[model samples]
Target: MYLLSKALIFPPVTEADDDGLLAIGGDLSVERLILAYNSGIFPWFNQGEPIIWYSPSQRMVLFPNELKISKSMRQIIRKGTFSITFNRHFKEVISNCKQMYRPGQGGTWITDEMEQAYIELHKKGIAKSVEVWQNNSLVGGLYGIDLGHVFCGESMFSKVSNASKMAFIYLVQKLEKENYKLIDCQVYNNHLASLGAKEISRDSFINYLNKV
Candidate 1:
């Protein structure tokens, strides 16, 4: 398997050879980091492994207006039971994400270094988090970076089956109110697809990303 070379990106839509791999090593400097995201690439690797970047042919994203909330979920929203907050308790949210293990999924990849780095970005207002609280306990949340009008979601976690969904629903509403353009779901998965995230060609994605 091959790997990315030095965090450098290939053509905007063209990814490095996918030998089940791409970049091998690189620092996540703020400049390179933002550039990578703008080009439809994102860093994801196991702890202790060199930073790897990926830009698959198909990208998953959510348009705020395109979100689909089910009838039952709508009923939950009517109760107003879960409280949503922004940029509050970011550390807790991330920690929970790191701890939750999905079935058949590998262990947490969000490392301490990554955590520290994102926290710095958050302090600088480049990153934001949406948290869900029930009965005074934080059961679900997500975090991501806000680049201009695009919100690049990183990860989320939920202890309750529908808790994260509630957080996502509230997040979309907040984004719509703020007039933010898109939510970069990063990769397609059954969970995200259920939330109405769709796949778009990488070129089209970068076109919209460049506008933001």
Candidate 2:
């Protein structure tokens, strides 16, 4: 593992440890965050810990064409019960994500500093958010780093059942229309798997990142 200095650089992803921890102690400046996502590395640590960077050997990703929408989700979409918007209410979306309680997790990885950092990224138009609303109230949403051809998904949350899925489905459809190569889900989980996201070798993922 490596320790990051003030310099805007990261060790090669190849040096990451078995758990994908590549480095620690980096600041989350907008420039560094942009470079990190473009290079296929991202920060993921709790609030009290030193900033940890990871480049997992197995990457979770979804090709826009491969996104799966279940029958119930499709029905909900057709009913027009939820509305979706991009880059709208970003801060709110992320705030909800920060406070959201996961099944087994005790704390959130989206620290206050991390929140401010990504907000800066949003100001620069490098990061984006998708908001899901029901009757003008924000219920679910997602946020990520947009690298043109490849979107590095950071996190998402839903207040109502399937609200986040609605946001995701919309984002995928939009990206597909724009010919995006893939959505980088970072690590794997059953939730993403159900949506057709699968693990690809880090090498393969880096290849996608290298696409011009």
Candidate 3:
């Protein structure tokens, strides 16, 4: 594994291992984090462990045109039971994501340092959040790094059923109107798959990043 130094640089994504682990031990500075996402790499590690960077050979992504909104989801949207906002309650949204419980997961990967770093990115207008509200109370939301043409999603949480889906669907619709290329999901997951996210080669993913 490659060990990073204080210098603001990262090895090429091609250098990542079979498991997509490219390097370890780098500070989550705003500059570095920006560089990482722009280069199609992201950090994922538990608290107390050295930051681990990954550039998977297979990248999960969703093209805006391909977003699947089921009949039920469409009904939910039509009902207007939930409202969506952009870049509102970002810290609160991420805080909920950090505390959200995923089956079989012992804890969250959003460490205090990571949280601060992303917040800094948000201040700089790089990180963005989508808040879902019901009755003026935050119910669900998602956050990610926006690269103009691509959005690299990080995490999302829901306080009620379909709340998180509401946030995601709204994001896809908004991005589609803006003519975005794709939403980088980072890895394959059933939830994203249901929304029409699919895996492509890392090389293909990087090609999109290069355009940003």
For every model shown, the clashing-pair count is: 5, 0, 0
Q: What are the runs in model 1 whose C-alpha is more than 4 Å off? A: 1-13, 18-21
lDDT, candidate 2, at 82? 95
Report the C-alpha lDDT of model 2 over 1-212, residue by residue, as the tens digit: 99899999999999998999999987999989988988889999997999999999999999999999999988999999998889978899899999999988989999999999999999999889999999899999999998989988989999999999998999999999999999999998999999999999999999999996
State each model's C-alpha RMSD to the native. 2.3, 0.7, 0.7
- What ranges in model 3 sit over 4 Å off? none
- Candidate 3 lDDT, tens digit per residue, 1-212? 78999999999899999999999987999999989999999999999999999999999999999999999988988899998899978999999999999999989999998899899999999999999999999999999999999999999999999999999998999999998899999999999999999999999998998885
Per-model TM-score, in order, reads 0.90, 0.99, 0.98
Clashing pairs in 2: none
What number of backbone clashes does candidate 2 have, counting pairs of residues 3 or more apart or in separate chains? Answer: 0
Q: Compared with the true structure, what per-residue lDDT tens digits does model 1 show for residues 1-212?
A: 24445545544346445432345566676666767767677778879787767777677899999899999999898998788898888888888888889788777788877787777777778878999989999989999888878888999999887889998888888898888888999778988898889988777787888895
TM-score of 1: 0.90
lDDT for 118 (candidate 1): 78
Ranking of predictions according to lDDT: 3, 2, 1
